[model samples]
Target: MFFEILKNLRKKFKRLYITMFKNYIIFVFLMLLVLSGTIGFMIFSIGKMVSSEDYIKDTQKFFMASKIVKSDYKKIDASKIVASKGWVEILNSNKKVIYVIGTKKDKVTSYTENELLNFMDLSYNNLKSGTSYFYSVTAFNSNGEDLYCIVKVPPGIVTLNVDIAPSPDKYIKKAAIYILVGIFIIIVFLTVSVFLYAYLTTKKVVMPLKKILQGIKRMTEEDYSTRINFNAENKFGEIRDAFNFMAEKIEASIFERNRMENLKQQLLSDISHDLKTPLTSIMGYSKALNDGVVENDKKIKQYLNIIYNKSKRTVSLIENLHEFTKLDNSKFLISKEECDFCEFVREIVSEYYNEFEEKNFELEINLPEDEIIYEFDKVEMERAISNIISNILKYNEVGTKAKIELTYDNSKIQLIIADDGVGIDESLKENIFEPFVRGDKSRYTKGGTGLGLSIANKIVQKHGGTLTLEKCKKYKTVFRLKL
Candidate 1:
């Protein structure tokens, strides 16, 4: 059950609505917002506590103002002996009420001096119930007589003892409004700061995602060359690098595929053109012989020879085509083994000695005497070597000297084949190793198929080696093989 839960968690994380980085930014912002709101409430609560204290002090001050009246209570005007939204009453030491002002005076006038004194000694709630008002008491001397003064404070203003001042309602309201505005401004400033931070931070995180989307769009349009050229200092940078690498690989793959397709079409066209001439001669001469159109024995023999030669050429062409196809398809594996490189070459060279003699060619062997053992596919390597020798035999004139030189470096085996033949033309040098590409236009009928160099090059490449036409001067041709 735990494993299942963990698996679900992993899946959720993989397909998360918000990335980890962006989610983290949002979480932090929410925390900051909560903190800002809490601080604002705290400030407002402190302001209210201070305001409540000021209200109690103001009530004490109103009590003091009421005591300032004389013992007779006639020196102060009844109208002036009042507070804003409050009333005042004075009593002599004899417990006789002096006067009452503001609000309903009947509640204060009914309270006996002893009764009010007892109420003042009780809790504030009892004091309000006895007088039916919220008021304060103070003792003072007027006309040399001790007196008790009661002053009623309005609900809107806090009772402060500092002075018999105006009602605090307007000032308190204004202060409360100012505090509220301050809290609102602080909240707005913090909100804007958090939102701005989130926007910039999220943009930084999501920028790479946008680039990835753009890259994918370009790829869908078959533009493999599109690459994200960003070097960021984060995990997204690794993603960008991987994306560029993939684009390069895909581009290379497409290029190679297109090149192979073109090669296939060219191969088909060349085959058709090459086969037509030989097939025509074979059919024509065979038809003549079957119709008894050639009466004499000598003429019939000549016709038969012509047909046989054409058939042989056609068969050779078909075999070469099949071999070329097998090599291109990447299905054939090289049978590799360890052997002495020098001995292998000597054996293949000895087989070609008779051909060299028949062509009136001089054979030269320049090989290092070192016994160099190398791993290679002997059959394929020999076939490649034979193709090169066959070209020498077919293209070079009589009395042309052919040289086979073998040498080695620390990392490779080098085979150099040079011949004083009718060398390749400069125009053909660029595409000398392409199939069915012949030089001078004369080698087509000189018993050459024009695929010799191409096949040899492919074979050598499969052995993890390279073969190239090193030089093709006027009468000098050199092909270099490296393994």
Candidate 2:
């Protein structure tokens, strides 16, 4: 029943507060239980010790009672003797009773001298056979008379009859006071110890929790600079580390998001700039022809050619934008199959043969005589190769050496395109594959959209291949493709 109440208290106290409070309550309760048990066990042990001894220690009290009856009964109150719960009997030297006090007259009061010698022994045996009692007999020294008496003392408070004086009441009261004081001292010491332990333990917990709460508050205010600086090897330490990691990730994500937003604004400006140049030229040329500004067949033909070219540039820009958008979408799908890569590039270069001749640019092709088969999306790969070739035509000087080389081993394939024209600007090399990035800043410098390299790189990557620019051994610039 006691344990059940303690268990209920533990549950109630636990729900009352935080973990630190729970520890404090449990520690105090345990200390109190230990103190109670210690005091209870000690008091019980003292009682057992006092009871284990025989009643022979009461002999001194009985001797004092015999003295009172022998010489001082007339001076002492009979009620006081009865209050001591003992009766007195005096016998003459002949062993006959002279007087009896505080008890009825009995047969053992008178005896022969020999009988008196054995009287106490027989009386004790009889008393043992009935109920337990304590008695004493001694020669009383009073008035120079030889007298003997027996005092039968009952079991209330027996006054000690020891020589040199004894005070039973004083000792008992002092012992009881000392026991109470000792218990109080122990309780005070235990209370102090319990509170000290609770204070130290709760401080350990609250200090770390305070630091963590401060960090979280900073994080809530969008301040990710501060860190939780806990070094303990415990669960709180794990919480601190995890919190730091989350804050770091959130900071990085915000930085990246801002960067992308700036890039998006820049892309819009570039697109508008590119489209406006062609549209302006087309509008001006058409207006001239409509207004009869070209008066002859030759001027009219030249104006028509200019208008057609401007229209074509505008169409190319829109197409490139659409293609890039599609490729950037993660859901965009491409069809793949095994095809002859060398033949595929050969066909693409053949389509550009007329343009190469018109521009007076040289075309060099290198391939193994046998067909080199590879898995790829045929239409996408052809578009990528055409974009590479188109970039060479648009950027390279006329009559520059333009070479296409295909090399393969057991595991992979490499395709190289080189041109002996002005290489990419050193400043733009790092971001050459970025969307709408071109060597020449002016949209009219080269009559093409700048998305060629960017779109080509994306297509090659989608086919589990990479496209990168590298230093050429025999050419001004080279673009290498590895699959």
Best by lDDT: 1
User: Residue 53 error for model 1, in Å?
Assistant: 36
Writing each residue's lDDT as its tens digit, candidate 1 over 300-330 gives 9999898889899989989888877788778
lDDT of 2 by residue, 1-483 (tens): 323533543554355346657777887798878778767866775565445432223213333444445364345334544656666677777777787777743467576766555545643324442433345566665577787766655533442334214445644564586578768878788878878886765565567678877987887788967588866565566666766777787788788788778868978988998899989999998999999888999989998999998899899999999999899889998899998988887788789989899988877889877788888999988889888888888877788888988898987899999898878788888888888788666435767688888999999999889998887567877999999
- In candidate 2, the residue pairs with backbone N, CA or C atoms under 3 Å apart (3 or more residues apart, or in different chains) clash, namely none
Angstrom error at residue 19, model 2: 14
In the order shown, what is each candidate's alpha-carbon RMSD?
13.2, 14.9
Q: Indicate which candidate wins on TM-score.
A: 1
In model 1, which regions exceed 4 Å deviation?
1-204, 357-364, 398-402, 420-422, 425-431, 472-477
